[model samples]
Target: MSFTLHKKEKLKSKKLIEQLFAEGKSVSNYPVKLIYLKTVHDDGSKIKTGVTASKRNFKSAVNRNRIKRLMRECYRLNKPLIFNNIVGDYAFMFLYLGKDMPTYEHLEATFKLLFKKLIIKENHEKLN
Candidate 1:
């Protein structure tokens, strides 16, 4: 799979976003938390993802935007972990949960751990 995160791969539906928070399960590694929901999409994409940084924590649009950019970049690079390992289409939201600014290295490491945890959790669920 390509390493680019295409427009269709972005999660933009208001209804879907609401439902995701309502029914989605989450995996977290410190400053990063991934919330995911299994669902079909009309676009036939394997996954649709969104990233956010809390305004309360960030306090500035620039900081929040920077955090969000780093989150998306990390997800874009590491998404194959989910696409190759998981079997179904999913909607995902990555939330920044820390009170301080984050470095790219920190986010990348957290993302890898978070995705691994998600994979393990999904595999365990399937086995049950």
Candidate 2:
């Protein structure tokens, strides 16, 4: 894979988010929630993603923004692993669930674990 930002896709639209939340499966191990669904877009190579930090967890915009930044950075760095497993165009949302932000190491390790689990979960779901 190129691992270029040019191939990075954006997941927009309220309906898509809601559908992913309602119908897709979530993998959570504290501090992070991965919600994903295989979406049929015209372009199968696109992998659209969205990041969110709940306002309920952190009222301050700075805190929320910080968490989002961390999530995006981790995703940008580690997305190749995810891209490899995706069968087609997909939409994903990463939500921060921790009360306080963790260190980069903590986030990176946890994010890696989460993605690994997600790949397993996706395979399990596909068989059913």
Candidate 3:
């Protein structure tokens, strides 16, 4: 599969987003919190992702956009870690919870760890 973050891979349904935040399981590793739900889509992708940078922390749109830019790029580059390991569909929201902007290296490392946790999480779910 190509390593491109395609438009179809984005989570855009308001209802699905609401359900995700309301009932999805969440895992955090400092500065980042990953909320995910086991969900299927008509599209053939294994993962659908959404990203956020809270307005409460960074009041300006530019700052929020920049943080989102960094996070999306980090996720785009590293998402296959989870995609290659999972068996079913999943919707993920990667929330930035840090007080300050993080370097790409920090975010990338956290993302790798996060995907590993998600793999373990999915495995446990399958067994249960």
Per candidate, the number of residue pairs that clash is: 0, 0, 0
Clashing pairs in 2: none
Off by over 4 Å in 3: none
Worst 10 residues of 1 by lDDT: 75-84
Cα lDDT of model 1 by residue, 34-97, tens digit? 8999999999888999999998887899999999999999998988888899998999999999
User: Mind giving the per-residue lDDT tens digits that candidate 2 earns over 50-125?
Assistant: 8999898899999898888888888888888888885667888998889987788788888899999988988887
Q: Number of the top candidate by TM-score? A: 1
All candidates in order of TM-score, best leading:
1, 3, 2
* Candidate 3 residue-wise lDDT, 27-102, digit = tens: 8887999999988888897788999989999999998898888889988988778778888888999999998988
How close to the true structure is residue 95 of candidate 1, measured as C-alpha lDDT? 94
User: Which of candidates 2 and 3 reaches a greater lDDT?
Assistant: 3
lDDT of 1 at 79: 83
Model 1 TM-score on a 0 to 1 scale: 0.98
Cα displacement (angstroms), candidate 3, residue 119, comes to 1.0
RMSD of 3: 1.1
